[model samples]
Target chain A: MFEAVYQYRDQLLHGLGMTLAVAIASFVIGFLIAAVLAPLAVYGGPFLRRAIMGYVALIRGLPELLVIFLIFYGGTVFMTKIAGRYIEVNALTAGIASLSIVAAAYLTEILRGALLSVAHGQWEGALSLGFRRPRAFLMIILPQMMLRALPGLGNQWLVVLKESALVSVVGLEELMRKSVVGAGATHQPLAFYLTAAALYIMVTGVSTLLLKAYEARLIPHMR
Target chain B: MSLDLFLPAFLAVKNGFLLTVAITIASFALGQILALPLALGLTSTRQAIRVPVSTYTFLIRGSPLLVQLFIIYYGLGQIELVRNSFLWPVLRSPVYCAILAIGLNSAAYAAELLAGGIRQLPTGQWEAGRALGLHRTALLLKIILPQAYRSVLPAIGNELVLVMKGSTLASAVTVLEMTGAARVFVARSYAPFETFLIAGTIYLVMGAVFGRIFRFIEIKVAIPGR
Candidate 1:
């Protein structure tokens, strides 16, 4: 009943906090990774471009669940061995790292597409000014690249927010995991799960509105 | 951990292969069947139908499939009414729940892809089909669908890889599929890396094979690179 919801209020809040923490941290890290790898994939030498493409192919193709398991269970033991002590892989850290890695591959492609959209002649213009490729990328190319990829990046954020649920496999006390616990404890699987679904709906709803709002403000500038 | 001793890894793959294929095939067929009509509905101009179709697509597309799977399977099982109803026979089965989850998820995404493909068709083709005495069903079946499939095969192929991976969610509901069985193997073998590595390798190979098949299909209709 309502009492169950009230009883688990603190736990649910704690779980929500963890989910958002991982979602924000992983997405920010993924964006940073994407911003760095994107232009490399687009403009690097054949070998480097191949390396980036190979990375995207491998990570994007592999199951996120497998990656999570690799990092959470497998990496923990490897880390412990290296550290000469017990290095536990808690739910939060694993959730953040695996999600960042997984999201990075997708974001790289999104960003590369955006960067490639910048007219090749722009680079030529930079070259005419005797600006090195790095200087051109730093001074002129990046600011416009951000504008092109912003909407796609927004969609990716929605994905990150939702896919965070999967990290619950590592026993992360996020909404999905908390709902499982709530179901087991309350013996009301239907209610708790439906509630979890609603919570997801809520998060997605507000965030979509926020994205649309931000896009509205920025669209005029792009136009 | 001897690199030389790889029997268990081999055995796990042998054991879990069928379940993996079963989940993939079942979801793929179901997704396509559901997607075609859902796509038509989405692209249709009818306001009544459009609203609900968009809502379904929005909700499913916006949220994570993992949460949807958990909500449908583990969440519904706790319902007294569902337990009491005749649907319980179907609902109690984890396979059915997994199918429902994968079906719904793929339907939403594939519908959008299908819609995009449909839109890509030159409107003149439809008029041409109409001029040739083709009605709605005839034009759609013979003219639009084939062309639409070309534009969408790549996206659908990507979705197929997603479905194959999403099938792992079935493990959460106590289904002893590849990932599920891998968990047990890891616990018993206490070689976490080896077990997971084996599981990951299986998925990668499956994805690689699927990618090649899709490429072959894509070549049939793909525009040559500029």
Candidate 2:
């Protein structure tokens, strides 16, 4: 297994690059989407809030693979229909979009939970200090939420990384898809998979430790 | 738009829908049973047990379920020993492999949740149990596990919903679950959009229904005060 992994080192490295790229790209996009959606879900009017909540529920409920599949195939068809011409949706594009949607749903919830964890009195305190609502939220509430949201966001990052593997089915040359190709070529399915699993473990386990240490450092200030 | 395919697609995928439900229920049940010991191991004082169990959970959690399924479904069968072993019959079928992979993955997650619940148990409760002349075994059985279960009920509910969604990946291994059925239809009709839209709706309904049930159970089983 180790020999096979070594022999396929270049291929595997390329796959790893793709996986990290997709994960990082989707995470940034998802974070922005969550930022907009979380505030709406938390503070919007009743009808708007319900609409956002329902969107979250639908995304959360469906499988990520299905979402990717639907987006890849359905998006192509929909776009083709709109233009009355073929519009090929690339595998990488579909994967990132679907993963972003899923990540956004979970991130929204995480942010909302963190926001709620900030004491109601803190918001009132800022308002009483002569700052307008937007300025108060930006200066006071946002910092505390970030502190509280760190641990959950760390876990969500791991989730997005792992979920990126599903994009392999869409023919995205991410780590898992590359591993599949390598396994088929080498007849070392076990080695390729175990190596993939190990890579995932290393990425997630190490990042989690770093995130936790960071969270620990921030804890005193939040307190 | 293939709106005409809607009823046929719905009817065609009925078996797949049932299979999905079966896999989810079976995996969740087995995972819950395995989770107890795993949770206990996680909360154990000994590093020998705790380290190994924690590593297992971490590895399982870090990796995607699709990879795990591929490992078990395709990778395991490639092993000469596995092919020669008594477990070959079970390992040969894609459905059985899906159950094992999904079950173990979920058990790892539930174990973490359960262990966290156990750890959060008040130290005063343990002291009270010890002060009441309860043995360690009796204390854990009567006092600890019950409270931990209550606290972890909602989390376990989340785990079930996760299992339901995760089970869709079994289609990659030819399990013919909802997603699998839709893929088959797409292959034949070349209508990915309509077929998947139907399958997605079914999954959405399943999730909503299960979510409501979990919420109901959580409210009904809420502790009197805490």
Candidate 3:
């Protein structure tokens, strides 16, 4: 078992790299979307808030795989029809897009929750200090919100990282797909998958540790 | 604009909805059964018991359920030992593999949630129980566990929603569940948008309904002052 995994070390590493890249890309894109949607969902006027709420609800309820298919297969078809030509949307792009969209929904919720946890008095206090609304939010509220949101953001990152495995169905050669391919080629499915599971466990384990440490560091300051 | 297509597409895939429900219920039931022992193990003081349970939860929670499904469906099936074992009959079916995979995944999550709830019981409660001369098992069963379940009901509902959504991954392993039905329809009709739109709507409805039920439970079961 060890020999089989050791022999495929390079392939596994490459797959790990791809998994991290896809996860990180999704996180960045999702954070950007969260930056827009979270505020709208939390404090926007009625119309904008309702629109964001609907999007979040739909995304939260649907399966990630179905969303991926809709974006990859459905998006491809729609684009090709519009362009009156074949438009290539690769598996990686599809994976990142779908994961980011889902992440954005969850992230919006997390951020909104964190923002709400910040007392209304804090905002009022900032306003009484003659700070404009945007400045008060950025200068007074954002830092505390980041501290509160960090753990949730970390969990969301882990979620995207794990969900990246689903991208394998689209034929992206990420960790899960590579493990499957290796298992098939080597005829040692257990060895390859155990290795894959172990790798995931390791990444997630280290992430939990790092997040805990980060939270610990921030705790004293919060007091 | 393509609203007319949704009815036939939905009709064709409605059975898949039942399959999805079956998978979710079976998996959730199995998870609930297994969670009790695992949750106990999690709250144990002995490193021997705690470490393994913690690691198991960590592992399952960390990885994608898709990989876990593939591992069981494809990975375990490859082993000569497994293929020849008494369990081979059960392992041969993709449905069993999907259930086992998702069930175990859900068990890990459920165990963690229950453990968290158990830990949150006021230490004073346990001390009060001891003062009353209650046996350990009686104390746990009558006092701690019941309150733990109440506290964790909302969290467990969240887990159920997850299991339901996760069951859609069974589509990958040749199970024609709701998502799988949509995949088949798209293959035949070449209508990716309409097929998935209907499927996505069904999932959204299931989630919305469950979300409301969980909220109602949380409010109904709230402790008077707390």
Candidate 4:
């Protein structure tokens, strides 16, 4: 039962690496986009705020799997039209793009909440200290908002890690897809899947612990 | 680009739409039933009960639902005992397996939600019920549960949407839900965008309808003050 896992250990490890790569890449890119969008949504004019809200609502309404399918298939068609020739959208690109889009929407909300939680007095204090608006935001306000957003960002990271599994549907050789192939070849679906689940549990468990420790360090008084 | 496929795609996914709705409703109902006992166990004073309940939720919540679904739909079939057992009749069906997997997953989250609600209630409420000559079960059922559930109503509404989104994974197991129907239609007509757009719209509408229903229930049940 377990022998098949050991025999295919390298494949599983490689798959794990791919899964982490996709998760981290999409998360970092999504966070950058949300960092911009959150402040814009909070401070920008009514039109800008409404447009950002609409994007977030539209993305949140659809299933993540559906989003993956839309990007994977629609992207191929889009690229084909642009170039006047068929160009397949690879699974890795499609997976990252869709997950980033989904993550950006959720993270935007989280960051928006975090930004609002920071007091208006802080902004006024920065202005009174003879700092320009952008300089004040970058030097003082952003750091405090990020600290407040850490817990939510950590939660979103876990969500992204789990969601990365959906990338396997489009043929990305991630942990889920690797388990599928291993189960097929070894004819031991239970063992392969259990191994995958255990790996996922291990990663999430470590992440939770690390986040807790980091949060404790940053906000000891709150704890 | 394929404007012609929109109406036809909508027609094709009509059965799929119903299947998605059925799976979401059934799985959520199943999850609610399972969550009640698990939530009780989570809030229990006994180490024996609380430890195991928390561990179960931790494990279930840690792993992805797709992996869990595969473990049930494909993995269970690998075992000779499960294959030979009377339960195999239900286990053999992909639709049942999807529901069971998703329901179980939803139960873990719901249990945590319920447990949090229970924890939030003032201890005075429990003491008050006990002082009124209520037994443990009566105190829980009559006093603790109603308020706990009411406090968590909005979270429960959110869970409904999450479960509805999760039902899309049933397509991976060949359950022919909305996503599956769109996949089939896309394969046949080579119009992925139009078909998926229609299917996605159906999902959005269903989510909005469920949200409205839950919002109405929340309003109807809301306590007058505090």
Candidate 4 C-alpha lDDT tens digits along A14-94: 999999999999999999999899999999999999999989988888999999999998899889999999999999999
Query: By DockQ, who's the top model here?
Result: 4
- How displaced is residue B226 in candidate 2, in Å? 5.8
lDDT digits (tens) for residues B132-222 of candidate 2: 9999999999999989998898888888889998889988888899998888887787677788888889888888788789889888877
**Superposed model 3: Cα runs more than 4 Å off:** A219-223, B1-4, B212-226
Docking class of 2: medium
DockQ for all candidate structures vs. native: 0.70, 0.78, 0.79, 0.86
- Which ten residues in a row are the worst by lDDT in model 4 chain A? A214-223
Runs of candidate 4 exceeding 4 Å displacement: none
Per-model root-mean-square deviation over C-alphas: 2.3, 1.6, 1.8, 1.2
**Comparing 2 and 4 on DockQ, the stronger one:** 4
lDDT (10s digit) by residue, model 1, range A131-216 = 99889988878877888888899889988998899998889889879878887888776677667777787888998899888778
**How do all models score by TM-score?**
0.93, 0.96, 0.95, 0.98
Docking class of 4: high
Lowest lDDT block of 10, candidate 4 chain B: B1-10
lDDT of each: 0.84, 0.90, 0.90, 0.93
Which order, best to worst by DockQ? 4, 3, 2, 1
In order of TM-score, best first, we have 4, 2, 3, 1
Using lDDT as the measure, the top candidate is 4
Clashes of each: 0, 0, 0, 0
User: What is the lDDT ranking, best to worst?
Assistant: 4, 2, 3, 1
Q: What's the residue-level lDDT of A40 in candidate 3?
A: 80
